[model samples]
Target: MTARDEIPLRDADQVMRLSRMGSFHQSRLSFMRILLRRMRNENWQFDAPDWHVNENGVGRAVYTVHGPSRAYSLVAFAHDLPDEMRSDRVIATAWDTTFTLFDGIPTDDDIARLAQNVPLQEAGRISVRELTLSRANRSARLWDFVVANLSAGRQPDPESLKTVGYVMRTTAVYGSGKFGAADHGTIQDRPEFAAPFQAEMLTVYLIRCFVMDLLDHNAKCAGGKRAVKLSPKLRRALGIGNSTGLGMAPFLVNHPTLLHQWIAARETALARVRGIKTVTDGERDVMIHHAKSAHINAMNWHSQHPMQIAKVTELQSDMVMLCKEITRIGDAPYPWDRLYRWAAQNLTSEGLEQVVSILMEPYGDVVDDLADAMSIDESAHFYIDGTQAMGHVKSLIAKHFDWALKTDFGAGDEQARFWYVSAAKLEPRLGERDAEQGHELEQPLAIGRDVAALYRAITQDETVAHFLRKHPEHRHILRRVQMVEKFPYAEIRDNLLHAQMMPIDMLRCKLSFFGATHFDPRSDRWLRICMFQNAPFPDELYVPGNWVYPEPTGAI
Candidate 1:
């Protein structure tokens, strides 16, 4: 296929806007969805060769996954962790479980070597025989309840799930050459995992299966080994839990080119649908299906945080309104194009964007093609081509990102804060310069303030190259400015240091793309989200690609 044939031609302004990116929801183009697509297309087979979890759920287990080109294994090390040690905090030294993705079945010596380092997380460096590395902790309150209820030969109250959904929450799921695994460069060519972030998703998916096994085994071990397995429907409702904190905030800023690629692909997919001048009766049916599915999913979404609850409720109301308007023009020609116009004009940010997310579902042919090209040549677009004059650079910024320029960083509250990497866990944390300490080693994530600084410096420059020679340190921000000039949606529009900054919004933007549903906020700074809840299991890849946004009954 030619360059034009690869991705749809989208407006640079629309794709580059950060607020739009921050507002993004998951679509068929998400990493997890595409990875599942590739996995199923390959007809990957999974086998459980070693299942030795004792009745107490403290034992060893191994799952063998057979891909077309390679055989991989998930070697799990489960242990008895005291209540004090089972913390989800980044500062915690231990977890209820640790697992590694081996290239193939390991020898006894290999297993022994891994057991030494996998649990150490950041403290220990793993060597490169591994593909992905991760660790998880049990939900403190829910784990004991499941054990107690099952030990009494009774099914745990399924409603108990309505609160803290998953039994285990993964502290971190690392891949792409993390610790000692093969860096993405070495393994990106593997057809099974070429799509961005697929390895991480697969690791979590397999972990979900392992957790179910552990729960059932413990019930059997405590009760009479006659404990009933959870119904497939309830199992389908469960998801791999993720306790995301500021650990994820920096990634969106650090990987500019990759961020640009993700938003670019999404915008391109939407543009293709909006430009569609015709739709058959069958195509109209698909669009309506997506609309209703989205409405139900939004309605069924649950969260305790009032802010998130309000956002979801608004989305539900908006989805209903959208569904009503959608039927009015169902028989019209180019139905999807009209629907796009209506949504853009009427729906709010959460609702309109979510509709765009769902619309991509009905046209998998388009979404699948765009989703195929996930990896990006980020370095290729890294440098600021100095050929353009100072005026030209500033002009693009002013025209495309006037909102960022309007931010008043001079105010105490606006620039009063800083983001730091914690020494204990090496995770990101936000702090106030006046109210708290640690402003000395602030991370380079405050893009709005810095980009404005670079903008003023460039305006007074004699030449673009001369400007860089005098201020080489601002090279990173310069590249980002140049990139945002082309891909407008790449940066967040809001000031990060402002008192009203909702970090949860930032987390929601990324989680929604992982096909996460229930966004229960533990606090403004951190939240709990459920991933792969309604998603098809590894065994169901044989079914269809349109199983992502399941019906309300199916969507957890």
Candidate 2:
């Protein structure tokens, strides 16, 4: 349907705001669901060929999945990391377990080769046969408690499972040629890996399986004949945990076209759903069921960050109000649209986004195809449009960067933060411009401020080529200005360098797109999240429907 025939997509200014982007919720178009749906449709097969861990949980395992054309194996090396050495920070040297997603079943030599490097992380180097290199630290209290309880011939408390959703939280999962692994370009053409981060997602999924298996192995080793396997419901609840920080924040800014496709796909999905004038009884039931499920999830969501705690409280209240108000659903014309409007008027941003997510649940046929459109040939947008006149560039900025122009970066507080790469781990870090020493070496992440500077330096009459020839430094932002003309969601409108800017906003926006849930922020800089929670393991791929959302009973 054309824009005139349906609700137009939300305005970029409104959608791209940090607050709204931060409030984003996973939908039918999320990458994780897309990957699982494909694998299930293809009837993939999974098996563990090797498990040699001992009572001390120090050994290796090989879990592999055979897809339509190829097989990928997660070769896991478990270690008995000392309590003093375990840390979630990227700079940490040792982990409880290390893994590499090998291109296929590895031979004894290949396993031996990886064991030497995988645990060393950044210091170690893997070969091109490896697709991903990752490491994880056990959730100490939960791991020990579960082992202790299971070793004594009993299940760990479900309440404890609810509190700590994962046995191990991945500190890092490196892919795409990082540390000598096979580049994404090598596998992007494979149907199973065509979607964004499919390899990485699969890596994490298989890792979850291994972690579960490891727990069982450890229990049997600790308590000989009495050890038992976890119930399917409990097993499904344990997802792989991820500790993400400022390092991920630059990805959205650096890959503007890709970011645009992601946001645009979700917006287009929302627009299509809002366009429906008639809602079938089945669609209505589905919406109500998912809303109720989401409410349960919100109630169970835990966070220590003050802002996140307040937002979750507001969301719990919003869900209560929504449940009561939805009784009037049949009275409204364009009920989904009307519900969205009501949410905007009555709910917090967090609540409003939850409404958007649940609205897309029943309309999968209308929105699922949009995931195909989420990947962009970002290289196509990398070239500078040198032929455009300076006046044209200025006009483009005026149209797309009005928020940047209004920002007063000259003020110390307004320009208080800068993004830089840490020397210790070579990861991105946000530094205070007033207290930190590296503002001069700031990464190009502060696009809004740089665009403002570019606006001031240009003259209307000159060509972009002419201006850049004299001032080479404006070249990067000039390309961004040109790219934004076609990809409106290319730039975050807020001043990222401002003291008030929250890197967590960027993290939440990206993670939600990956279909993560139960965000529990540890600080404003980094957060802990669960991925594939309540999702079917690869062996149970035949039935993954609605696994991303929790059941009303709070079981998988």
Candidate 3:
């Protein structure tokens, strides 16, 4: 068969299930990879125009990247946060460092203004010239080890680096009109900001560079002439860690159109790769090479949480099976499709999703363009079609939300949890419906439960406009039902209020799109992940090809 007879996209019923969504791995289309690829292709230039930190690591530095049309700078401020004051929670007011991604190269006067407010975070204010605001704390376990060893002119153990993964972990990275920063609408027209989260991804990438530089400077000051800089390979292995919590879980539910575009882009890429009628020897070899690297990545992945530990264990076994199976498959026609079909039946969801990511590794020419289509003007889909008949609406509900229709929301387990905004921090929080006093103030995140209610409320054979006038409570869900008709992957096929529901599953799904790796869950509500791990720094962007997985020899 020809490529024109491409494999159809996977059904939303199969792909949108929370179990499968949570099992997703980063692919070539991940936002981080997309940003890096663009930077490399455009021949972007990076430099540190100023570094004024003292031996105490208390000062400000500026790192800038000159793109084809514009220059953006990361103005980072280092603080001497006491051990007692350090915290990863949003309620905390202090951090080891705070940064903002300035829209362009900022002048000395602009720096003076930023210095006054950036460190105060939420309590501070920024102008529209800023794109993002973020803060990170040093890792308690790995920070001292690296500092002591580097100060003594010795390299920290690679095993230790592998164990902890990063010197600092960002507690939060705020953007998109947050804290007076420029709204996404202002920057969406720019070519560099075309893709979703490109600005935030760029901010994190530069932060990685700043973290390495700070470590080197602090070590030199402590040991005088005896200190040494980190080797390039070891530095490359370190990534910027992030502590993500329940606050991120609502994104996928709230931004239906955007979520659909992201998932649709990925699903399209997978279908294109699976449609290949012939696999060349070179393509087959590249697949095997990355498969081995993926195996090593899985082996080195560590997590203390029981759920993640079990998933990682299964992933390790799946990689081994995949390596042996891919080699034996040989040069068969439609080899990728054949391997994917086999994996679906033999492997767990974690391994099965990894196979999907690996299949696209050899076909960048076919899939990379999908990155451009990932962003959406969600406002265009906001208008409701009030003229549609109730029968048509019922059919749309049946087609897209069958899982919700089947669920018994009346049961205690089905409606056990409620999502709320915490009064103190104004962050999204999950609470027990039965035991909590604030169930009366719950947010409208229970899409499944609401859809079920909408289904019951639709007792008349009339237009949505007429039906809604009599029962206005169903207006929100009716808009969602209509939206899902055009966007198949828009709604997650699960009951968000179910007692067994894991919010980490929602967090993992979003982070994977950001190209995060090493998902170490701290609890059912939050997790820690490493970003740009094994990825090239700005100076090393000239080196090309897939860098998501580590070399076998260098594997920890």
Candidate 4:
């Protein structure tokens, strides 16, 4: 494609809006897909060298994956807790299972040491030899149903599987030095973990494997001679579930440079696909197949929250419209770009972003490489140019923080919410500014509001160095302001403290990048989502195809 035919990346202001970002769908660039593609290409091998669980399901098992140059093992400890004690809250002290990803294969002594700590979760301490620490609780209803049916030599009802996608849902997956696990810096240079969250994603992937095996073992013990194994089709239908809350919302705000890299890479991929001058017949077929599968996924996606219910309803309609539009693509130049422009005009933000994701499905060769660019050494962007003129800083604010400048923060609703860390768990929480206490200890996550205040504080033309001498409070935002001048997509262009701002939107934006689906919000503050649903297990990694969306015939 020539320069004239090539489309430019979408503007940050248009693309970084919280509403649009929340509407994003996973494409081939998602970390999970990137990790899976690499494992398959390298011909990784997976095995469970140790399975010590008894009939009561209270024992330990180790699942390990041998890669090209390294091996990581997931050390899992199963518990037989009473149903009343099982909870998904962060404060919960017990779980159905707990796990830690070891840097390499662990010996009996290493396993014994981990056995004492992994199950304790937050109360436990790990060493640098571990990469991640996590805990999960079983979906009591689905677990019971599946186990009972399988033990009696029967498959689970597909509709029941559809209603609750996973047998167990992880409440928390702590990594990167949290709870004393290995830091990202220690493992980042490794080829396997070069992409963001590959270590954690691999942990969850292997956990899924263990979860399936544990279920099979329990069924055999209960039924004796009549027990049957879960079919591969049903096994592929389930995935690891995750419960996320406000703790994740501030991440997008705290790591501006890293967030920019992710958004820029995705936008670049979309631009490249849109620039394609013509689509071959095989490429067109791939698009049609994924589009139909996306439609089925939309129809199958379930949520009880009114907001998500409405969004899913709109997405279903959008997919139908998209499939019909795909049928009309004839011998037109730049057909993908044409379809994108049509979507921009005709569809809602939800449908429009869906089209952007679907368009990239047929062009993996052009987009897959972008995954490598998703991660960065954020410390390189930490230095502030204190010598910059105050005039230049104000102009940067004018160009990037116009949305913040125009907002009326003095209004009660404009600043109704405040984010703060709870003293008990030290996790981020939101409170009503007017009715709630602890607004005095608010965190520095209200970036737009802070930028507005910084603009007002600049009263004279001088160097930023001199300004910081008198007012050091503006230092944090000043660094961010300078960063945004170089990275346009570095900031989320919205008021995070507004009363109407749904934290779920921020959570969904980050989770979608992790390749999560079935966003079921339990409330505005927290939600349940499924990861790797319809994805192949490690044993089936050799099978090649896009498995993010289910096949039409596989739909419930």
Count clashes in each candidate, considering only residues at least 3 apart in sequence or on different chains.
10, 0, 0, 0
Candidate 3's clash total is 0
TM-score of each: 0.91, 0.97, 0.98, 0.98
Q: What does candidate 4's lDDT look like per residue over 46-126, in tens digits?
A: 875589999998899999889999999999999999999999888999999999999999999999999999999999999
Candidate 1 TM-score over all chains jointly: 0.91
Per-residue CA lDDT of model 1 for 199-276, tens digit only, reads: 777778788888877877777777776567666656666677888888887777788667666766777788777666
Q: Is candidate 1 or candidate 2 better by TM-score?
A: 2
Candidate 1 regions exceeding 4 Å error are 1-22, 146-157, 386-388, 459-461, 544-546, 552-556
| TM-score, structure 3 vs. true | 0.98
- In candidate 4, how many clashes are counted? 0
| Cα RMSDs, all models | 3.2, 2.0, 1.6, 1.7
Candidate with maximal lDDT? 3
Clashes of 1: 10
Better of 2 and 3 by TM-score: 3
Point out the higher-scoring one by lDDT: 1 or 4.
4
TM-score computed on alpha carbons, candidate 4: 0.98
Q: What is the Cα-based lDDT of residue 507 in candidate 3?
A: 90
- Per-candidate local distance difference test: 0.74, 0.87, 0.91, 0.90
Evaluated against the true structure, the overall lDDT of model 3 is 0.91
Model 1 pairs whose backbones collide: 15-489, 16-487, 16-488, 16-489, 16-490, 17-488, 17-489, 18-491, 55-221, 177-183
**Residue 17, candidate 2: how far off, in angstroms?**
1.2
